[model samples]
Target: MDLILRCLIFSLLHQSLYSKPYNIDGLLENGTGAIESLAKPLQDISTKDYSWAKGNQTCSQLLKDCKEFLDLLPSSSSWMLKPVLALGFLQVGCLTEQEPFFLDLIKDKNARTLFNIMAEQTNNSIHPTTTNSHKSQPDIQKHDLLRFNLESLSIDAQSISHHMHCSEIQQEQQDVLLKGSILRSHSSLQHAMDHCDRVGPVCAGVTSDTLGQFKSVARNGGYIIPHVGSKLWLHHCTAGLLRRRSTDPECHSEKELRIHNVMQWIPVVSGYYNAGSAIYYATQGCTAQAEDRAIDASIDLGYDALFTATGGVSGAVSAGVGMAVKPPLRDGVKSAINYFKAQWSG
Candidate 1:
């Protein structure tokens, strides 16, 4: 028994000493290879006037391949694979029609480094230097000297945001809905600003302005309004107003009324309309200045007045009627809104 134990210990020690350090390099190389393979196809789709069907098919395939590559990666090295995963998702988002899954990725440090690398690569590809033509590069050059910064990352993110078929308003709405806290809404906004700092000023300005508007709405009693359905409905309405205000600060109340009508029926459809409107006015670009002015105007006029002018009375009556018939729903709405108010104020 002693002899057998000694042999087992010796064998285990030898294996431990000789085993490979996690092959991060190999994993990164494979990831880059996957990215490069999809890049050309993505480039073609962007530059060419292809039909939506054709482009969507190509995008779907790329997404599949990306998923396959990710699935094959060793589960133990998932932390190391975040950047690669971020890059793959970004590429797919640039080509696909749906909203991109990039918000969480943008929050990751490793993913940001990968974004910087891609941006640098893109910059070099766009403007190649003539002096480096004579050098013979080694197969495995060290990128330890490569500096990753926010400037390139911001540019890359902005470019991706533009291609993803959603407006800044829609993006901001999604950001709030996903990450915003009904309670601790202030902290949520702060977290968003922290994220924006990593992403750069373009995002910071927009995110700040949008969240500021949300705060303004909360401060002004917009959130506690009875019969508004839910905070989500209120958020959707605010986004529509903000998007319209991004262009015409003095946009007619008729549009606002239409939105209120839609919300009264199918609150979700209003969200879709707002998203579509955002795409339609995507070129207008929701600047911080525009948003600030809009907020000021909305506040000066008062949200209650705006809602009242845009058919709030009828909607309130309808909600009252519904509440009268369904005591549970009425209680639920009261409890929910009260809880929301407590969180908002707290």
Candidate 2:
């Protein structure tokens, strides 16, 4: 009996030593279960009909449901669990009618804890720690982790879209879909902007400024881009010009330089033209292109005015020359120009 016991102990130790370290399946199952539990309260809040007469009562019920749902969230810090937590936050935020109540609930200690968890998880996911331990791991493990995170994000995003009834939710879903595609293609920031442009003005309106900041940072070698609003306009114009050059061969040829010179000589000339045309169309009850032209004119006028104040004719000419060049230094040069423009605007 002593000999049998000794043999059994040896077998158990060997098995333990060779076992797999990570439990991918277990984590996925736990995530799914947590999502299901959290989803129930959100669904109830979304589908119920509340009359204005019962507004206060409805608000109270909404807060109760949100608080309970938040309380049910698991406290695990595993990166795998972030997706469901993100989904819960998104669902609660989409409750536009209960905004006031929802705002109040976030003040609770428990609600703040969950929000901090999500924010910390997001930061860690974006800039993962690279310690000695992480360095020792195989590349395959890192790849698998990334793939798992993206898969989980996609799944939870779909779930949020299906259950939430808001335009903002739909926009978030579209952003997730675009991000996945952008990752697969391994394209530059400019390419991502192009994708947004192709998705139509709604997508562009939503993502343009953010993408512009990203592009500016990338072009500046990871430095923060300056100017809150002016850089945004310059980036928008640069992206528009880049897109135009890509789609229209004429914009790339030597002939385009002449047109660029014309615009350079008469600062804000195109701004005046576009603004006049916008006013004409607006008076005639035409809306489609009128609004777009008006926006363009505003950007042009702003760009010219800001640059003229800071660097005068030289600045305006330099900016025009920068945009007229080919794609090599387009983003970097434009960013530099905007930096000066931003300094003056401030």
- Whole-model lDDT values for every prediction: 0.27, 0.27
Q: What's the lDDT of the predicted structure labeled candidate 1?
A: 0.27
Q: Write the per-residue lDDT of candidate 2 for residues 1-346, one digit (tens) a residue.
A: 6446545643443222211111122223575653443333322122212122121234345435435433432221111112222223233333442455444544333233333322332222221122333221222221122222222222122222223222211111111111111211213545644544443322311222334322211111111111223222111111111112112442232322222222222212233334333333322323323333433443333322222211111211122211110111223323434443353345
**What would the TM-scores of all predictions be?**
0.20, 0.16
Q: In candidate 1, what residue range of length 10 has the lowest lDDT sum?
A: 139-148
Candidate with the greatest TM-score versus the true structure: 1
Candidate 2 C-alpha error for residue 337, in Å: 13
Screening candidate 2 with a backbone cut-off below 3 angstroms (N, C-alpha, C), the clashing residue pairs are none
Q: RMSD in angstroms, all models?
A: 26.7, 27.4
Give candidate 1 misplaced runs (Cα > 4 Å).
Answer: 1-57, 75-85, 88-100, 104-107, 120-126, 131-346
